[model samples]
Target: MGKVTGFMEYARLEEGYEPVPKRLKNWKEFVIGLSAEDSQKQAARCMDCGTPFCNNGCPVNNIIPDFNDLVYRQDWQQAIAVLHSTNNFPEFTGRVCPAPCEAACTLNVNDDAVGIKSIEHAIIDRAWLEGWVQPQPAAVKTGKKVAVVGSGPAGLAAAQQLARVGHAVTVFEKNSRIGGLLRYGIPDFKMEKSHIDRRIDQMKAEGVEFRINTLVGDLPKDGPAAKVTNDATTTITPAQLQAEFDAVLLTGGAESPRDLPVPGRELEGVHFAMEFLPQQNKVVAGDKLKDQLRAEGKHVVVIGGGDTGSDCVGTSNRHGAASVTQFELMPQPPEVENRPMTWPYWPVKLRTSSSHEEGCERQFAIATKSFNAGTGKDKGRIKSLTTVKLEWKGGKFTEVPGSEQEWKADLVLLAMGFVAPIASVLDAFGVDKDARGNAKASTDLSGGYATNVPKVFAAGDMRRGQSLVVWAIREGRQAARAVDEFLMGASDLPR
Candidate 1:
């Protein structure tokens, strides 16, 4: 509401990116954030609608209008304060969130939505540059210990909240590093590791302890689950955590990738996206990986049309793949959404990520039938795959007759998305699981996030199945409040 006619006077300004050819050579963030002036103009586009749907549209229910107004008025400090009041890491969400808030913007019904994500990016980046982000240590110690398993957005959010409320918090990560999916799942080209590092430093200064390479529970010894990244040198059982900590929060994300049970799936060149992605991230972090999976000089086929699949395409291009092709089981969505019908809600529309723009041949309404192995010297490695076109009829996919085809491919990356959290970990804690295999937990205001087991709570993908990072952070913050109430009989922390 800073300027009533601002929306009519200003057009949305998008963030910029580096040239594709030049950015392909390095694994670093390429997005050129909106400048102060551009951000102000974009923020000025926020209409003074009677109701701001963007607040509820955001996973954390951020005060969107206030931040937009602050940014429009050039109040950088206040803008970040409003941003951090709801989000623990605007840097992460600002960089990677799909920006459902923008989709729900009042202006979006008839015009381009305000550039909320870009404004957030500018505010946080500026705040960091101005030394506005600092440690907020508690003045009094609660003397209660809390254990947070997994260092992803959810776990980090919960740990920071609990630590700020004067509780002793220790975060356990199975990987060698602190960030869970942020460090391994996301490519550096989208968001660099330095953001996670600085947050870890701030959390450390705020009296939170991080135990990297520590597994809270056992993982399956073999199978697809076993292939998940784990560099744990120490394993602590659920019983030990229950005895040692006042509360235990499970934020370990959904790590079980949905497998494609097709012929020749055992081919050496076929791998899960996680298997290939984490290795590249580790390499980028200066870790030497033995027999690293590379797409260089190979015909790469990435199965799945989600963000993970797009990421695969980008990484493959960075690896100098001869070609990259992405497949989608469903038909392609419309390029533009019908705002009249889907206003104030996330609409189904075609989304082409920066990775897709780099270079990728996308196939929709297709299904893979089998992987084929190579001959002689290339035996045991994937060579090609058979696919079939599908038609959507009567609410299900039916393969089209006489549409079978084989595509040449030297490597196949399965990026169909995660199914659920590692079952072994949930079982170890004696936590009940939903039909979908996610930890069974309710979000009820009374005893929300509480698992069946005593003193154990579950949040994020572990409880809700695979979802956006912003949702994970929301669950983490809410779970922290739930745990706080359980410990002190009440809580002042925001839900």
Candidate 2:
């Protein structure tokens, strides 16, 4: 617990941000992090609430109040120790996580919640600055080998945990680089890739092997019908991997996007969110992209009101789009949640992203009817979007009469979210899948992350479907413990 009256004495302090006008010019993180003193004061706001809902609210069950108390006591190293005990990468979560912990804070009933996220950000950064963060090499080698297929947060967490417990861990990534979505899907402006690079270095120092450009699946005999990014000349077959590794953990993420199957879906201008996001991230990493997906001087319409949609808006703004508009099929939510009605659970409320602040017209209660492809020579390209006004009636969406309208647009980005993990990958491994197409695995203490297939396991988005990075890390850690127990008939690893 923190100071007895700290909650009453200290008001929540928020971290500052770079001006929109200045930040829009470059693809760099513009967050003005809180000063050391202010961050400590924010940490002091943590109260002696009998039940810490912040722990339950956090996906990884981070010891928020403990770290907050540590920080308030100016024990930066101890604060980070408390943080790292639960979260493998507090830096990533602190930067991007929506901080449901704050929502579940007791102080949030009438006052601002403890600035847990910012305190986390401050602790990890201080730990790094003070060189407290280092590779923890295993004391003894178990001679067990594990292959974690994915370099996202989940896979990374699992690999690190296994390696620290004396298992030889090798991470397989299909992309040319590691850090799956962190290296590709997320823009550098939101979080610098150096965070990932340094972590990779630390993992390497801890004796974990990283294999990039190694796709774990059958090769398309005739090559892809359309160009997709990956460097695997012949995809590493799952059979080969299973035979090579003692235990195989599939954490490849949900890559299959949910497509809008309306007319003109194949138009050249309409692209999935992943296709647009990774390209910019690559460009930011100094890769020369051929015919980059630029929103330059084009009327941009983004479908989906989620984080991916917001990302599209920010990228489009940087691309200098003529105008950016977002469409959401659902009705607009209230500005603030009624905390009394939904205390511990995450509530439905309007969320405006940093991208939204840059510039964008957001339309709720609207549905895309169809794409309007131009005539003649431009028949394969999108020219506009025809949308229909929608209304909620009897808890269902209904189209408004005579509300159909067309808006001219040169580009349309679909951020409609992912449906499931790629079926081909799961099929290759002969792993059973859930109804949602995610890898089916029981999370029981005995079987843990075991799949129907012997010696095979699943975690992260591949097992849980689309989810947060923090959840992925938690699943990865839990799966690692399960795998260790399976191999050794017991495990000292944290659950």
Candidate 3:
């Protein structure tokens, strides 16, 4: 978009990070963003292909090339404007998004893709520093009320959009603070909570009401909510929400974690990723708890190779773990992908995260047969994991005979992905569910995001199952448009 041959002339410049030894000392972001000149050079790499597949690759449909061109020309003000036109929280995605757009970059066909994410990070940070990011409360009030259940990315996005469009939007969160998983499930090291707090402030300025420590739907007087971060003893019924608000939108994300049904699963010292991650996030925020979980001097075994598992590994290292090991059931993919076959698409290949760089052992194609309970000196806790090698054939895994092994583990965290939204909430609202247990609502343009129930709608993980923040944002924005259309004859809001 800048120099015709910028891609050929300039090499990719990735963000820098603090050394592992230094970064592990605290729960803070360590990635140093690209400099202005470096960001401009990287933006110049954008070929601005006639058909930009990166636009489609991004779930939010960000106008990537336009911003890249703007940044390349050092039009930083217009760059931020263009970025905000599509993305409500580039700051969130810039830090946490896996950058699928880069994978679909036209130049990625046979060369290093344009550093789209780094440029996005640069644009948003500069916008904040220059005081360009500000609230735009509607000039006129619509007198319409929308009740948003959940304070996760999807709920927050929908609430912000609706509030900006003059709807009285109230966001319900059960946690003590807002930002849902962003404030709890994620470690502060990957992305500090300040980003979410600032956005919350902006949203509040835009007239969005945030009811923290208030549950929208029912929660058992005592349930898994305690294990997570539930501070409110009060609950709001679905009927109350539907009756009070002109429209109701469900964005309460998938929270039903996939469990490992094996022997000794109930043993002490075994936990879910959400259970482990939130506690540390709270600790970093200056919260204290009795018998807080720590990995210090313990052999930690994290049972999943996804981002959540990687977070566990990094947190353990910070806790001064004696050793750490991660397990993945699927066989490892090649270190590099076949560009010709997988061009313009997310490729299947080995991905080593920054956390893996700290220090940890990784095992692939391994199945956990059971958890071995420790006794005697170790005392009624998880002592080891019994596993077996697997042979992948015909889309299923078959255990290899006589390939059993068990390793000592003082603590184990299950990092398997979530299955669906909390069942009670959906049931309370009487919303239909997909086979996967997510709320059932078609994405068809004619009646997109609407539930079978009149005046009620659903979006994000609650409807689509577990997904990235970008996808949640897209759903939230689209659902807002749908809700706006339903409230009026039609909507001027972007779809």
Candidate 4:
């Protein structure tokens, strides 16, 4: 709305990236954010659509048009204020969220959508550089204690909101570090760890205590689910939390990865993506690791075509793998979606991430049959795997006859995505679970986020299953409001 006709005058400007050759050498953010002038031009492209669907399209319902107008007018401080008013961590969403807001933009119906994510990146990065981001401690204390189990986006968002509302909040993390998924799951090439560190510092200044390496519930001593990253030295039970805190929020991620239970799955080098990813993250954080899973000089095969699989591709390339190949069970989507039919909604289209661009041979509609072990000296280690092509017919996949094949694979990383949260934590709390194994909780305004168990709540991936970080933040903020109302009988915090 800042420039009525600007949308017609300007073409979309995409963010730049470092050359693949130079970026593959180190683990660091490679995106080149838009300059102020470029960001202003991009923001000016926002049209005065009668109903801004982008607001609702965003999981946190960010005030998109307002921030766009502010950026167009070169109001940097105001832009960040609008951004933070909705999203607790624009740096995380700006870097990793797959901009559903842009997909719902009015301009996207006929032309390129506004570069909203890039503008957000510029705003937050600029705000940090200008010292606009600082601690916002409460003036008065409520003396009520709240326990947040998990330190990912959802837990962090909820803790910040409750702390700002004058409640004493303590976040418990099982890992040695604060950030659960953001610290270990995401590669540094996508987003640096320093972003999470600064936010932790700010939260500490706001009176939110973070207890790292603290497990609030029991975890399986051994199993596939046990492979989840955990370094807890202290374990607290549900009864202790219920007695000590006025409210308990379960915000842990969906850590139970889906497995391929084919023959020879027990072979060495066939590991879950989590098992391989966290080690590299620790190594990047300067934690020396022995027997680290390295892809160097190995034929790597990453199963599942998703963000996690793409991340594996990037990491494998960084490790100087001999070859990297990715497999997808579903058929490849169209290169471009039919905008006329799917306007104002997320569409199914082929996506090529930066990791895929680096180097990866991707195969679609392929299913693994079994992992094959090597012979003699290489016994017990995976050497290759059998696969079969599939054809979709009558809503079912029928294997193609005579299409069986074997491919060399010294390392097989299963990244088929997480199935649910670990069940032990919910069992410890005696919280009910949905059919999908996620904590059973509603999002209604009345009694929202409350579990069947008394004084216990659930949100984020723990409640909604695997989802975007933006959605996690939204659930966390809303859960905080719900808890506030439950504790005080009313709340003024924004949903």
Candidate 5:
């Protein structure tokens, strides 16, 4: 340990955000990163616990203690190296990951946990600024071809790993841009697209090819819709991908949004979080979207308390909404988890996101009864919502008597989370799916990522269902190893 008693000496410090008034004016990253000295002190607080549960706590199994020591010792280069060993994109996780590692930290038994995420953010950003991040091309090409569908974190991680192992990896994205959800589904204010752009450049230099606007199923342009690519006539099909590539890995995200079937769901102002988020990201990317979904001067009601819902609140704040309110069916959780019982595991507790801190009226234990859209002038537009308190008994949720109420709501966003991967893409490939609609594949080493369909593999949200970005990266990296081993008899890539 760099400083044996550093944990006792230094308290945890986290990055602050710009003032709400100043930050709401624009869609940009508002987090003020910790200074170098402060970051070092934060790192020094990492106690030399015999068992570093933070490593296992992290989805990607990040080498937390090693990097902490490296940072404390002023070894910036080594810190970045250790950090990148497990995570392909620390910048993404550092900014958005809930930091379960902190929950599992031994020091967190009583006092504040070490500021691991903040230190991680500092290391990666510093590495980029110092030009320490570079392309690590394979020594020689293996003459093997690998097709990775979807360019999300999972796809990107797999592509990078395969490319490093001498495989000719090609990442195909259906979108106009390379990044799948990262470029679209996430708001720009949470994470700028520039990080994805720079990583794309690094991957390109490492011999990984990127195909954008390449819809693999029906061929967007030539079939029914207009051509997606500029002046491109031909479109690629799933069958074509099966025949052209040596092995195929499905790394697409779970895009099937959970819909609200209640009345007024089809209203003009009602929308899925995916639809609303991507448009903002596109606008941030310099592509103007006509009639962008704005919550300006309107009562914005976001359903669901997950990250997507928080994003809606943040975006609405930027849009200058008349009022923002979020609803969660579940009751509000305790501010702090009972760590003695829940140690080393993610516990049920309240999580206040940066967006939540910005502003929003949050309500829990309340369920929306129905949309109160009158047959008046506002026929197709939402006007108000009828909600009531809920009671759980005998495995059923019942509405409380005399608890019904109506609230003004001009715009509503459903951010309840994705149910499964879009069935169309899975059906197109004829890939077997689990009961949950995720791709059927065993994670065993013998079979690796091989699905029922030979040479077809699945990873990320496609196989595992909806999950965090870090888990997606882990799956992608592991899938890459499985693919490599299947192709070349054995693989040296890390799991």
Candidate 6:
């Protein structure tokens, strides 16, 4: 779809980042994007593979080759239009998404894949700079009201699509701000909140109403606390929303984080990654935190080796921690994938994120056995941790004998991952739940996204489980189509 032989003529070039020392000093984005010429040349590498596996790899089914071709032809205006046709927030995905599409690119079989994400990032940023991005309000109002509970990616995408298609949409956010995780769970250095601010402005101009700091139903009482930057005092019942709106979409994310049940878990120096991350984000947003979970001059240990754990590492480094270490219970993956076996599919391999590159020691196949508080006035605060090595055999982990050791630890952050959506809101809406405790709904075309309640639907992490931002956007768009069809007897919206 791009220049026919461009892939053979040119090599790949990655995006740039600021120096570690300079970027660590402040909570701001540091990744420098591709130049116009660089992006155009990269786009020209698209092979026009007859069956684009990239579409399948991407949850949103982005028309990758067509957009690449458009960019190569210097039609920047139409490039963004084609992009927006499938995804609501390219800017968000461009910055934060792990590009599965690139992995599935045709060139990836024997060469570097087309820089699809970089192309996308360049397209949206250029569109924004050129004033090509604007609100597309509905030509006619449908006289139907949709109450989207949660302001995360799914809710935002659904709200925008429904609003553009003429539905009166009201977004209810438990947090004081419009963006849910985008505004709170994510750190500012990774993605500045201003991106969300601009999108919210566009959504508002398109006739969407936002009710921030308004909690729907009640929060789950037990679990690794899913902390929020929003200081919400307002509460709205499921019954009130059911009565007021013609349709309701439950897009609240998976809020219940998995916990570590062990000795000294209640120690003052130990906290969940959410608790630590949200506080830093709030502080970066200029909110004052009272004795917040600072890692300065203290040994910090993060329990988990995923993005959340990486985020903890970056944040702690920024706080000037004495030392930082990350532990993963599972064995480490190979540095590179075997392309022949895993072509066009996500492969299990070691990934080093930008945060990992900043500074931190990583340990694999290790498990925390216990914790201890030294004898002092701060006896309830953790001062040391006991851990053990593990061996994986037959899909089970067995502790290695004589491998137990103890180390000094002043702070600990639990980042194992999320297990379920907060049970309270789903229970309040009377929506059935899957075995894994997420809101249950089908994805069939006829009745997809409909919850047990007649007019209530569910999507995103709240309905599925913990996943990438791109998946959440896909669910939101699909659920919007389902809601539109249910309200209008049929929908012209994309599925």
Tens digit of per-residue lDDT, candidate 5, span 11-122: 9998989998898999889899999899999998999989999989998899999999998888999999999999999999988788899988989888889999999999
Residue pairs with backbone atoms closer than 3 Å in model 3 (clashes) = none
Clashing residue pairs in candidate 4 are: none
Q: Over all chains combined, what TM-score does candidate 1 have? A: 0.99
- After aligning candidate 2 to the native by TM-score, how far in Å is the CA of 50 from where it should be? 1.4
Positional deviation of residue 322's Cα in model 1 after best superposition, in angstroms: 0.2
How does each model score on TM-score? Answer: 0.99, 0.97, 0.98, 0.99, 0.96, 0.98
State the lDDT of candidate 1 residue by residue for 284-359, as single tens digits: 9999899999999999999999999999999999999999999999999999999999989999999999999999
Clashes per candidate, residues 3 or more apart or on different chains = 0, 0, 0, 0, 0, 1
Worst 10 residues of 5 by lDDT: 223-232
Lowest lDDT sum, 10 consecutive residues, model 2, at 219-228
lDDT of each: 0.96, 0.89, 0.90, 0.96, 0.87, 0.92
lDDT tens digits, residue span 1-495, model 6 = 658899988899899999999999999999999998999899989997799999999999999999999999999999999999999999999999999999999899999999999999999999999999999999999999999999999999999999999999999998768887888778899999999999999999999999988989887555554353447789999999999999999998887888898998888888888889988888888888798889999999999999899999999999999999999999999999888899899888999988888899999999999988978796888999999999987879999999998878999999999998888789998999999999999999998999989899999999999998999999999999999999999998998
Tally clashes: model 4: 0
Better of 4 and 6 by TM-score: 4
Using TM-score as the yardstick, the better of models 1 and 6 is 1
Model 6 Cα shift for residue 450 (angstroms): 0.5
- Tell me how far the alpha carbon of residue 345 in candidate 2 is from the true structure, in angstroms, after superposition: 0.7
What's model 5's overall lDDT? 0.87
Better of 1 and 2 by lDDT: 1
Worst 10 residues of 6 by lDDT: 221-230
